[model samples]
Target: MSRNLDLDLIRTFVAVADSGSMTVAANLLHMTQGAVSQQVKRLEDVLDCLLFVRKTRKLELSREGEAFLVKARQLLRLNDEIWADMTGQPLRGALRVGVPYDLVTRLAPAMKAFAEAHPHVDISLVCAASPELSDAVDSGHVDVSLLEYVASEAAGEVVGIEPLVWVNGRGSDAWRKRPLPLSMVDEHCAFRQVVLGALADKGIAWRTVFESGNIEATAATVRAGLAITAWLASTVPVGVEMLTPEATGLPALPAFAICLRFPATVQPAAQEFARYARESMANEPGTRRAQLANIA
Candidate 1:
């Protein structure tokens, strides 16, 4: 006789896979880490297949686990739809969300999911730099904001930690230039400050080659092999290659926290949207850092 998979266990497993850490999954589910571990173990026992390879700081999916993840997501989506049909009230309202320009692509999936789930809700997405997003959250310009903070100074729930990397045009050694050519979004960009400070500390002379608040322009400069710039590991565009500290003799930059911030007055719609963002960050494979390894 075949045993049926427990929905609760599956839910826990998805959370763990999405967040890449048991502790984070536990926090998201409001369960103890031990409880989350037991749930995963129980699920593995039921399937007779190991799901996750536990590591020092994160969980990596085993071959079987990777195969299961797709089906698991389908199951959860079906379950949510059924439950919503039975019990979910009509969620209708306008919600303003602030996000960093760099993260718009990363957050698109969650935003799309939320829009589809609630057809009547109007979502106004505002894209800006992290500091502006934070200010928007504080001043009630947005119901929720996703902001990047220096890892040590971050306060909100951390959805992800991204390594700051130096990137230049693919196959280009522009970083070797004396007084390194630099491109930046703006003076207020957190990455800019970090990069500048790291350069200063290393006594590495550098000159600004380009400065623009437009991500596209900055990217263009980098892609044209005109300069090197600092970017998060995951957000590096396709045309650029990451320059390793060992190769470039540049100081390693610190990680940054990707966090969700909420205003004091959060509507139900906003809250629900926030939940979707959190879940998306947890579940999206690209956001998962299986190991705290530095990006080379």
Candidate 2:
């Protein structure tokens, strides 16, 4: 006889995996932490495999857990699709969304979930710099936009704050250059503005060695040890090390606000998309802490 997997248990597991904390998953699911733990244990028992490697302060997925996560997400998505098909009005519309280039990777899971839940909604994604995204939202060129701005200048629902930090290739001597070689995006980039202003304020002589609208190219430049760049602590690409201001003698950068801007008349599809994005960002690993730390 084969045992059926409980949808509730699977949901609890996914929540825990996504949030990386039992307490957070419990709050999100409106269940006690003990209940969440029990559900996880029950799921593990059914699979006869340990899902998470319990650490002192964090929970990491074992190989088994990582493999299970992919299947679990698929199952949950299909379940949601079936339920939505059976018991609700189907959503059908076009939503044009603008997102900053750096945040696209961070928001991928949320976008995937939204796509799975609303198959009929046509989503057009526009990836650009923050200023361009904001302009798109203001000009009605896009239905919604996820943008980054200086905290004091932001005007939307603040989702999170990302700490700005200098980044360079790991094990590279790029920081020791007399006139620092800098890599940056285009002039309209908020990060570029902040980085340049910080360097100028500190009287640090720097020269732009690479400039591109492409984040990958800029990160590649940094990774090649040709230049150093600044990015959100969380968004720093792989193979790069975040530099400490004190040790590197670089000016400290203030946090940047991550926010959502939408048109006044939001369609149902757009509203649902926004809601999902908000919830995903809230539960996103590291986002909650940043949000809490930057509350002002």
Q: Candidate 1 regions off by >4 Å? A: 1-88, 284-296
Candidate 2 per-residue lDDT, tens place, 1-296, comes to 87799988888887677546788768667779999999999999999999999888978788998789778766765675566557778788888988887888877877899999889999999988888886676556788778898887664557887688888998888987969899887767888878888889998989989888789999988999999988877777778888887888888888888987764334556656876888776675565356334421
* Candidate 1 global lDDT: 0.80
Error of 2 at 233 (Å): 1.0
Number of the top lDDT candidate: 1
Best by TM-score: 1
On the 0 to 100 scale, the lDDT of residue 59 in model 2 is 86
Candidate 2 TM-score, C-alpha based? 0.66
lDDT over C-alpha atoms for residue 255 of model 1: 85
Clashing pairs in 1: 18-282
Q: What is the C-alpha RMSD of each candidate to the true structure, in Å?
A: 10.2, 14.3
Sum up the clashes in candidate 2: 0
